[model samples]
Target: MRDAQITDLPDIREIYNYYVANSTVTFDVDAMTLAAWRSKFYYLGKLGMPFIVAVSPAGQILGYALVSPWKEKRAYRFTVENSIYLGAASTGKGLGRVLLGELITRSKAAGLKEIIAVIADQGADASIKLHRDFGFEEIGRMGKVGYKFDRWLGTVLMQKSLK
Candidate 1:
């Protein structure tokens, strides 16, 4: 994994849109435009946060992982939330594990205290397992807190202490 560049936005958006359209992994209902994605990249860069991507040998972007502040409150400054996405073809190849491992390392280097993953309760076993492998433990569960795909969705809050 390495720092993502502006040129990688298209592939990133494509992969993300796929998830948006078909999965509960992200609650966003609409596929984001290139302009919006550019703004997201710029904001993360300005925040000095890491936005890293995994690429295939042929240079295709296979997946990405990023961390952002968990909340806007001053007291929550030390906590960050993480998200990860892998191309359908890239799943089960250990790419998510690799990306998450690097994310944890970057979070530690940034002096963050915690990495929280808000996982959709549906079809998130792999994600929960991945976080557990990195030492994250379930903190809470908000039942039926989200509605998506014509159904109610639950969320599981998992966190790992980085300090």
Candidate 2:
């Protein structure tokens, strides 16, 4: 895994858009534009958030993991929300686990006190197990909080204390 570069945006968008269109991992309905994606990169860079990408030796982007502020309030400054996405071919290769582990380590080093993962309840057992393996515990569940693909979706909130 390595720090992501601006050049990696296209591949990142591909993976993200795939999940957006076919899975409930992300709540976004529209595929984000390159400019919008660049804006996100800029914003996260400005916020000093960690954005790491897993890559093959041939320079293919396999997956990415990142963390951002959980809330905008000052009191929540030490808390962060994490996201991880794997390229279609890279799933179940232990890459997500490696990326998430690195993310948590870096987050702790950055003085973050907590990391939260908001996961879709459907077909999310792998993510839930991954987070649980990293010591995250289920903290809350919000039923029918999201609507997508003509159905209501539930979200499970899992958190790990970094401090």
Candidate 3:
């Protein structure tokens, strides 16, 4: 695992777009463009947020974990939302835990105070448990807020304090 370089953006985009096209892991119904990912990479770099990726011994990106500003307002500067996505081949290999652990450590080192996870309620038990194991607590749930895969989907909100 390491800090993501500009070259990693394509792999990151592929990893995330897999979920976008195949699952409700993300609400994005369309694949994100490389330019969009580049903009996000630059934005996080400017904020000094954690955006790290796990790679195979062959140097292929396996997964990634990052924290982005939770809100645009100045008062929300200390809080951020966390995102983790692994290539389909990388799941069930404990990479999520390692990436999330590293993400938390890096985020705290970057002086962020909190991390929030907004997870899809459908088919995401492992994710909920992963966050729980890391000391994130379920704070709330919003039901029927997202329509995807021909159904109404909800979100499970979890939060952890770095302090």
Candidate 4:
């Protein structure tokens, strides 16, 4: 895995948009255009967040992991929220673990004190297990807080202390 580049935005968006269209993994209801994806990518970059991607032997991007401010307030500067996405074919192959582990390492090295994972309760079995394996614990859960696909969804917030 390596730091994501401007060129990686399209691949990352493809992975993200799949979830948007096919599952409750994301609540975004609509697919993001390339321009909007670039803006989001630049926003993370401007915030000094880590955005990295995992690639296959042939240099195909398989997945991505990134972190952003947990909250906009100054008090939340040391804590960040994370997101991870993998290609449809990359699931259950340990790529998520590798990508997330690297992201955690990068966050710690950047002097961040905490990493929080806000995961969708539905279709999040792998992410829940992955974060658990890396020592993250569920700190809170909000039920029926999001509405999408004509149904309500919940979120599970897991956190890992980097210090």
Candidate 5:
């Protein structure tokens, strides 16, 4: 994995939009346009967060991982949340774990003290397992906090310390 470029936005957006529309992996109901996607990445860059992607030998983007502010408050500066998305056909591969592990390394290098993964719903077992395998512990769970696809969904928070 490597730093994401502006040109990689299209593939990233596509991978994310797929998860948005097809699953509770993300609570966002609307798929964002390329411009909106670019704006999000710009914000991450402005925050000095790492946004990395894994690519195929032919240069196709297989997956991406990023770090974002866990909260906007000053007290939360040392804590950052993470996001990872893969192409629909790419699930079940070990790529997500590798991508997230790289993000953790970057987070530590950035002097971030805590990393969190908020898995959207129980259906996202793979994500939960990924974070757990990396030594994250389940910190909390919110039930029916999100309404998507005509049903209530929950979120599980997993945390790991960079220090």
Candidate 6:
């Protein structure tokens, strides 16, 4: 695993967009374009956030993890929200644990105090378990907060503190 280069955006988008189109793991109704991903890439760069990707032995990107600003307000600068996506072939092999652990280490090194996880409650049991294993406590849940795949979905809000 290593810091994400700009060239990794397309693969990252592909991984994320797969979930966007085929699963409720993400609430996005439309696929995100490369341009939008570039914008987000730059935004996280400017914030000094950690955006890292896991690569296979053949140099293919297998998964990615990152943290974005939890809120725009200045007082919330020390906190960030986490996002992790793995290619379909990469799941269940402990890649998520490696990616998330590295992300937490980098976030702490970047002086971040908190990491928040906004996870889809449906079809994301593994994610919830992963976060809990990392000491992220479930703070709350929002029911029927999203409509996707022709059904109502909710979100589980989990948080971990670096301090």
On lDDT, the leading prediction is 6
In angstroms, the error of model 2 at 2 is 0.7
- Model 1 spans > 4 angstroms off: none
TM-score of 3: 0.99
Of candidates 4 and 1, the better by lDDT: 1
What Cα-based lDDT does every candidate model obtain?
Answer: 0.93, 0.93, 0.96, 0.92, 0.91, 0.97
Clashing pairs for predicted structure model 1, backbone only:
none
Clashes of 5: 0
User: TM-score: which is higher, 1 or 2?
Assistant: 2
Q: Write down the TM-score for model 1.
A: 0.97
Span of 10 residues, lowest total lDDT, candidate 1 = 106-115
TM-scores for the candidates? 0.97, 0.97, 0.99, 0.96, 0.97, 0.99
Model 4 C-alpha lDDT versus the unseen true structure: 0.92
Alpha carbon lDDT of residue 111, candidate 5?
87
Steric clashes per prediction: 0, 0, 0, 0, 0, 0
Candidate 2 lDDT, tens digit per residue, 65-135?
99999999999989999999999999999999999999998888788899999999997899999999999
Instruction: State the weakest 10-residue window (summed lDDT) of model 4.
Output: 40-49
Clashing pairs in 3: none
Off by over 4 Å in 4: none
After superposing candidate 6 on the true structure, give the runs of residues whose Cα lies further than 4 Å from its correct spot: none
Q: Evaluate model 2: give its TM-score.
A: 0.97
Instruction: Give the higher-lDDT candidate: 2 or 4.
Output: 2
Prediction 4 TM-score vs. true: 0.96
Q: For model 4, how does the per-residue alpha-carbon lDDT over 6-38 read when each residue is reduced to its tens digit?
A: 999889889999999999988899998999989
lDDT of 2 at 20: 90
Give the poorly placed runs of model 3, Cα more than 4 Å off: none
